[model samples]
Target: MALDLEGYLIDVERARGLEDIQTLILHLRDQYGVDHIVYHWVSSDGEQYGCGTYSPEWAQRYVDKDYLRVDPVVIGCFQRFHPVDWRKLDWSSKAARAFQAEARDYGVGRQGFSIPVRGPNGQFALLTVSHDCDDEAWDAFTLAHQRELILIAHYFNLKALELEHARAPEPIKSLSPREVDTLTFLAMGYSRGQVADMLSISEHTLRAYIESARFKLNAANTTHAITRAITEGLIVVGGTSRAADGGWPGRRTPS
Candidate 1:
């Protein structure tokens, strides 16, 4: 099952545009026998884009009503680093309850599981699967499907990132040696002072290195810089044998 899902993910990765993504979402919905599947992303400049199995009417209504303001999925997912179940979100608000009803009316399932993905430069995206199954069935399905969902979420995010890169005003800059060293230390759970002492630099210097790395990586902050560096293979986790000596890890050869 995992191998087959991997093949599906490879196909999804090859999708080139919004139309291709919409097709893939529909295909996955059918393959998994789910009621709906969606991929929605908000870029750094507040531009929204996505493709999914939601009805056109619902999509239009969502936009017309500006449901983005009260949608629990958007709110809850933004605050989370992991998958969220729809039931766990605060749908108790009158507006949220009305939105949920409208969503159901438009064929969005009553039950949902969403994975929130955060990318560099404040890019936020979500991959969600929704269905009308009972709680026990939904729970089991999500457990069975969690790994595949995560892979798909990452694949979707990568494609979006690629598109964003293609349309970017400036090319992303590569991290420098000192900048890489700073982020690597932070990624490995090092304190700024600890990293500075180890590198024979002052804490202020260390902060400058980190901030430079963050800017080069187009990251929103230090943590985001570390994550982007690791994801882009600019740094490797546990690849540092000299971590004990307070020395930075050897840099990866450029691919």
Candidate 2:
């Protein structure tokens, strides 16, 4: 079935609170014919929040069992800057295998796609969709909706950040010209040395500017910083970078 993506986005923007977001996720799960759709976030100060279509029993079981310690999806996705398929994550360890089995028994699907999201002020989140389906069907579904899902992931994070702002607003910091230039070049497929040379700065100076920008953006890494900068319209990429090597150069694709 074709999802009314435009309508869903409108509904998301109109969402007033976490309850609205949860309702939207439930709607998405049903509309996409998926077992579950989840949005989970952790703030820099260690606060956690989530909205999803998963059963309460299963959600409780996960916490009770401390399943995250052995959940390969969570661990793998945390280290990645792109979307991922569950099959690509390692589940070879006995503990991981046991956790997988437990999750399956709790109605978690065999197939899943997850997008990692990073927001300002050190927020980390994951937007995931899971379903019970054969490999071929799952592959087709993901291929057909990959771009939509990516857009939704970013939108979901944006909405969450908006909610945070309402709770306690913070002033945004503008990046220095050098920092902006460095990130723009990095996003455009230029090496660090290349960006430094183009900006007529030493590599050491460039690194300093980049690190400062990363701090201002509250990004976990250089790639994360570049992505946040681009998403926030702080910089524009003229070319693609090594960090975005696969299909779309500067855009991250599912692996």
Highest TM-score scorer:
1
lDDT for 101 (candidate 1) = 93
Worst 10 residues of 1 by lDDT: 241-250
lDDT tens digits, residue span 1-255, model 1: 233786788887887877788888888888889899999997556567788988889888887887888899998999787999999999999999999998999989889999999988777999999999899999999999898899889999998888777776474577777877777778889898899998999999888898888888888988898988877667666765223233234534453
After superposing candidate 1 on the true structure, give the runs of residues whose Cα lies further than 4 Å from its correct spot: 1-3, 169-255
Q: What is the C-alpha RMSD of each candidate to the true structure, in Å?
A: 13.3, 15.6
Per-candidate clashes, comma-separated: 0, 3
Cα lDDT over the full model 1: 0.84
- TM-score of candidate 1 on Cα atoms, chains taken together: 0.65
lDDT measured at residue 143 in model 2 versus the true structure, 0 to 100: 94
- The collision pairs in model 2 are 188-239, 189-240, 189-241
Residue 131 CA displacement from its true place in model 2, Å: 0.8
